[model samples]
Target: MDGMQGAAGTVRSGEVIKPAIAFESVHLDLGGREVLRDVSFSLPSGSFGCVIGPSGSGKTTVLRLAGGFLQAKNGSVCVGGVPRSGPSRDVAVVFQDYGRALLPWRDSYGNVSLALEAAGVPRSERKDRIERLLTTVGLGKHLHKYPSEMSGGMQQRLQIARCLAQEPRILLMDEPFGALDAMTRQTLQDELLRLVSDSGMTVLFVTHDLEEALYLGDVVVALAANPGRVDRVVTVPLPSPRSQLATREHSEFLRLRRELFGLMQDGHG
Candidate 1:
């Protein structure tokens, strides 16, 4: 259902009129070095999109641009119909390094509650919301556990819960699950799909893992290195509620994987 249905009797709205996030002919130069070039694409509201590319391809730089950490030198980066030139509360970023994303001294709940607190959410509401989010990410039992005491996967879940606390229009993730073990990574992937679908929030994730990108993204945007630019955008044809074992065997999944691999190969040229 993607969790947007509000009414049964009334014909549901065709689609919510959510604003677009896009890069219009964007170029980025970091400290005199060209990082991204002519990058442009528009993501529909509530859609999950991914940007994949080779090492040093500026994939993370694009995420920064989207998060307003870096501004485009040649074109523009827009979020919800306004030009985003600096960090704003409307955007939330989840980085690969949980150690950096999380506060070292805070427990899981504390980390998430702080974000809600900063937003001026009532203290009572913050506690309730933090509990719900930790539970949603399967961390309910570990709410009081500090990051140093938790496993890598739990730390990552805490990071996700913190992002959810912000209630941002867009979630920007840079290789968020890349550091976890295979089994933990897959488990978190399923949880992420469930969370994003339930929340109906837009996500722009960056990863070099082709399989991870296909598994999580509604549309996968491929890029090339050495002055990165969009190479192609591929849509995942597999239906929702995708499972690790079953989805790998789906014919459409295999086909899409092959096509994306070919495109990535071409991009490396």
Candidate 2:
């Protein structure tokens, strides 16, 4: 193993630390097709966990289980130590299709206001709260801009702003930056790290890119396709507040990349 290898345990130093998200012996079948089998993992509060694998590996399925959009036939999907019954305000999801996710008829403010409104935020305080959420995702100046008026990156930011309005404890992201240009994706990745750090929101991000998984995740969970199952779990040892340049250049990063690449080559995906 190139990096620290382990699953997130339930206890830390004799103290029970409940994970923000936990999947235990999870199995699922869609249309008589086994999508996932005996899948399990945990994400500590405020930690970034990335799930990576080939197409049809059920990466998004795993995140959806956490979001309560899809249910597992066996085992449990728990959030904040409680079994997920259905969608809750405590979990917010950011989809990869930013264009479809945002409202074309709504401006940035209105788009973000939808969440607060759904959460029953008061009409009197909506403006300030919306402004703050927009500002956090770097959309402060584009408050009046519609989805068509903004670039892809801006549209994604607006979507993120809306999700943040729910004040979620856990964030589920499904390849959120996969469609953006290289520079835009990198920029958004950094912004996401900053936002999560400030909010202390646990994240379960699904991606196909191995390098992206390593750079952004505290734990990179690789899956094997055709009934997706956990293949490897690598706990990153790179220092926190990772640098796009220096971190990638570090020997450990390169080593982990090769290791994961080798895992993919071994028919795990």
Best by TM-score: 2
Residue pair clashes in candidate 1: none
User: Candidate 2: how large is its RMSD?
Assistant: 6.3
lDDT of 1 by residue, 188-222 (tens): 99989999899889999999889888888888888
Candidate 2 C-alpha lDDT tens digits along 1-269: 42333332323422367788989999999999999999998888889999999887899999889999888889999998889888999899999999999989999999999998998989999999999889899988999999999999999999999999999999999999999999999999999999999999999999988899999999999998887899988998988798899999989999999999976665542
For residue 179, model 1's alpha carbon misses the true position, in angstroms, by: 0.5
Backbone clashes for every candidate come to 0, 0
lDDT of 1 at 189: 90
| Pairs that collide, model 2 | none
**Candidate topping lDDT:** 2
Candidate no. 1 TM-score: 0.90
